[model samples]
Target chain A: MSLRNALLAMLTSQPMTGYDVYKNFQTSVGYVWHAPDSQIYPELRRMEQDGLIRGETVPWGKRGTKKRYSITEAGVESFQAWLNAPPEYQRERDPVRLRAAYLEWAKPDASAEFFRAHTAYHAGRIEDWEEMIAALRDQSNPTLAKRIEGKSAEEARRITAYKVFAYEGMIARARAEIAWAEKGLELVEELERRV
Target chain B: MSLRNALLAMLTSQPMTGYDVYKNFQTSVGYVWHAPDSQIYPELRRMEQDGLIRGETVPWGKRGTKKRYSITEAGVESFQAWLNAPPEYQRERDPVRLRAAYLEWAKPDASAEFFRAHTAYHAGRIEDWEEMIAALRDQSNPTLAKRIEGKSAEEARRITAYKVFAYEGMIARARAEIAWAEKGLELVEELERRV
Candidate 1:
């Protein structure tokens, strides 16, 4: 359901061929709501069937034709409705936390390695999100540039600010995770000393 | 697969009936790896068939009989393998962050409401996790109490410390979320003032 809304949001910027959508998604919306090409292609077809998006046959490279999809008026209304509705929170299902609780079951070296890997993973995510914030600021991102093309200066600022804000939230989360993993590493060492 | 590991973790504390597993899951492992009774029961059957667990017919109240499951040596080995294995991280698909990125498309009030709800939801989770930590500290949580039964003082301390650390990680995440949403609320107001 959220994937459908994500697709609708992507189409709102401009109509794009399926290939273009797949290409552009990686640099833009995929950071927040990831869907592989497999999922994206099927979802686009479903959105078309549901009348939330309209697909047109368009010229591609040379003799090729491709289907380009644009969000419908209904799509805009649906997106707005979803945006306004109360957010549905999923129950916690964190595998890391589950592992953490039972670190007693793991060898000390394995526990330390687990925390190191956790820190490294989240550190990489922080770097990605920080780069995203930079891209949002300078309007170097093609999808963002397209979205703000005809908008007023204030509107463009609002658009850009929201994206930066969203990415910052992701960065905050990654930072928190990294910090927790560091503490976990220290705990593992302390436990080993006692043993 | 993680669900299977979670169930194995539960059984490691003590053997339990299928009903007992479902009942106790809500308070302990359920917080980390949530599964419905529908999933738990079928997985228990599959695990027994796969020799990860052994089930015995136990007399229940009156003329009823119930299946009680105990983790096999294979189950212990499997759980240890999982705990020591490299963790698998899911790609991001956060609905809140996805919505956050497109706040320009939403009404200001709706945007503010979304942030408020996010804050409130995480605040509630923080409370739940904090209580869990307290329960772990006092050995009042039935599962933890059972797990540490007959263990040495040092063993009990290590067990309690790891569980506390896991819940603390959860609280840290919830705190980060609350802080982010608070900033989001402020951003919404700032944007609306310029309108």
Candidate 2:
């Protein structure tokens, strides 16, 4: 459902061929709600079938034709409804934390490596999200710029602000994770020293 | 697979009936790797079939017999293999952040309500994690006590420390979420005021 809504949101900016959607999604909404090309193609077909989006065959490179998808009024309504509704929270299913709780089962070096990897993963995410926030702030992001085109100054501000806010939230989380993992590294060293 | 590992971790403490596993899970490893009784029961059966755990018929309440599961040596080796391996990182698919990025599409009041719900939900989780941390600190948690029963002082300390560390990570995340949502509420107010 989130993937469907993410596609709908992408289309709200402009109708795009499936390739365009796949390409642009990596640089935009894909930061928040990741869908690989595998999921994106099938979801586009389903959304077209469901009438949330209308598809038309459009010219591609040379003799090629590709299906371009545009959000219908129904798509806009569905996206709005999802936005207005209370977000459903999933229960905690954190695999890292799960392993953290049982680190006694892991060798000391393995435990240290685990936290280092955790830190490295989130540090990379922070870099991606920071790049996104920069793009949103400058209105340089292609998707965002398109979304804000023809909108009033106030409307554009609102749009850009929320997107920036969302990316900031991601940055904050990634930073927290890095901090926790660093502490985990310290804990691993301390535990090994005691042993 | 995580659920299977979580179950194996639980059985490391002692053999238990499926009912006991379901009950104890809600208070212990379930915090990090949540699974409903529906999934737990079937996974236990599968673990038995796969030789990761051994199940025996035990007398139950006078007239009935129930299957109690114990972790086999194979289970411990599998769990250790998982712990020693680098954790797999899932790409970001945060529904809240996705919705946050599009809050401009929502009504002002609805946006406010969304942030409120976000705050309340994580606030509740913070409370749960805090209580768990307290339990772990005092070795008052039944599962922790059982796990450390025959351990040396240093071994017990490692067991307790890792569990505490895990719960603290959860609390840290919940706090970060609450802070983000509070900022979101302020953003909503500021956005609505300009309108």
Candidate 3:
């Protein structure tokens, strides 16, 4: 997702300081998309210049001066138009797989160490995603809950069901990775000891 | 990986016509990387100008002349240096998640239908990857298998294991999506009937 569009979407929901945008990313949108403050703040400035969003620098009670951004008429129109356009294509460059391709270059012991850590990292991510989904389910907003409502007994079980599913897949894959890693480690250790 | 580096590496294995590079993409490299003919041919021309690779016109047995390419010493040095360098960082965009984000704006039924097809597509990919792995396993080349040896057990495992894990993850995730889509479809169908 374009950081600019994400910022505009947040502003349309309500006017927000850049700090507020940062918070939204951490709590909600960050689950699927991420932009560090470095990217966000700069994009915000560019958007202001383009007249897609208007910003006002205001001093708050204690938080000091911060630029509060709101979607301009043009911003909303732009976002709507963007929505009608085709989604950007997805591309993945999995580091683990790439490194795996060149594994023979490394000593067996070192390779084993790498896979163990790699599998563990993905497992952690899956766990974090699950925890986030659980928290979303417990959210108190009626409208949010309604967004998850089902006609029958099956569908109403969760909010962000898609994420939950995706996470489950990730977890399953991680486990498989762990299994493969363990087996590889055993084999490599033997080879290393012999060599 | 930069297509530049990838193309350079391929040339080091042997000289190839632009058509050969294109064919290699479909056969071996597409498993890890992809490039269209449009990108490949233009890049070949660019590399020739840069002196990274040289192209020669070779007459085919039956067909007209083809532009065959071979890596210059500079190209071989460049590719090996790249292999030792850090991998380029990549950002991935998931269109299914993007669609899910805007699900609120979609007809509930329409949203479900989209996921239903999306789930099936992912499921097919997982199955296909599994088949590819099985075929590779049955191949007799020890050099290719040797390519996987010597890494840590986890690393070695990661070589072949990660793909299966990733595939399984996709399947599980797709199933979860299908379940959610079915619920959404049921709800929308009920509403339609009521009207």
Candidate 4:
């Protein structure tokens, strides 16, 4: 359901070819929500069929045709309804964390390796989030730029600010994960020292 | 696959009926990886079929027969293999964060309400995590006690420490979410003032 809303939300600004939607998803919201093209293409087609969006077979370049999707009024209402709905308990299903829960069964060195990898991974994500924030600030983020193109100055500011806030949340998450991993590494070192 | 390993890990303590597995999953590892009884029951059957576990029909209290499952050598090997495997990127699908990304479409007060509710929700979770950690420290946590039974002092400390580390990571996550939600509230207020 969130995926459907994400697709509709992406089309709120302007009509986009399925390819454009996929590319935008990969670059922008993919950090918050990841969907491969296999899921993205089919979901686009289904949304078109559900009448939440309309697809127009328009000219792609000069010699090709592509079905571009745009949100309908129904889609806007639907997205609003979703946004206003009460939140559900998000089921946690993090595999790395799950593995960490059972790491006592592994060697202490392997446990150290696990946290080292966790630290490095989130460190990379911290960079990704920072880069995204920079992109959003400079109007260099095409996905967001397309979304806010025709809005009033204040409206555009609100739109841009919301996205920036979202990435800031991600940055905080990454930083906390890095800290947790470092603590885990310390725990491993202590265990090895004792064992 | 992780669920299977979790089921196997839970059985490492002693033979547990399917009901026991469900209860343990609800409290202990369930925080890290959620699985409903529907999935749990079927997975248990599959594991028994695969010879990773042996289910014996034992008399429960004086009433009826219940199947209690125990991990075989194969199950132990399989669980260890999963613990040592390389981690994969866990795709994030958080609805609150996704909704936050599109809050510009809502009223400023509505946006503020969203973050406020998020703040409240994770605040409650922070308490839950804190309580769980306290239980772990006091040796009153049954799931952890079972997992560490019949171990040397050093080995038991390692096991207990790993579970604590996992819960600490969860605490870190909840704290980050609270901070993010607070920041989001500030962003909403700032946007409203500017508008």
In order, the B-chain TM-scores come to 0.98, 0.96, 0.65, 0.93
Candidate 2 lDDT by residue in tens digits, A1-195: 899988888998999988888899899998998888888999899898999999999877899888888999999999999998888988889898999999999999999999999999998998899998999889889998999999999889989999999999998888889889999999999987852
Q: lDDT by residue for model 3 over A111-180, one digit each (tens)?
A: 6666567566656667776776676567443333544554343434423454344444445545656665
Off by over 4 Å in 2: none
Indicate which candidate wins on DockQ: 1
Q: Give the Cα-based TM-score of candidate 4 against the true structure.
A: 0.94
Better of 1 and 4 by lDDT: 1
Best-to-worst order by TM-score is 1, 2, 4, 3
- Model 1 residue A189 distance off true place after TM-score fit, in angstroms: 0.7
For candidate 4, write residues A113-164 as lDDT tens digits: 8888888888888888888889988989998888778889877888888888
The positional error of residue B68 in candidate 1, measured at the CA in angstroms, is 0.4
Ranking by DockQ: 1, 2, 4, 3
Evaluation by lDDT, superior candidate among 2 and 3: 2
Q: Pick the candidate with the highest lDDT.
A: 1
- lDDT on C-alpha atoms for all candidate structures: 0.92, 0.91, 0.59, 0.83
| Candidate 1 backbone clash number | 0
TM-score of chain B of 3: 0.65
Worst 10 residues of 4 chain A by lDDT: A85-94
Residue A79's lDDT within candidate 2 is 92
Model 4: what TM-score for its first chain?
Answer: 0.93
* Complex DockQ, candidate 2: 0.88
Locate the minimum summed-lDDT window of 10 residues in model 1 chain B: B186-195
Can you tell me the DockQ of model 1?
A: 0.90
Lowest summed lDDT over 10 consecutive residues: which window, candidate 3 chain B? Answer: B139-148
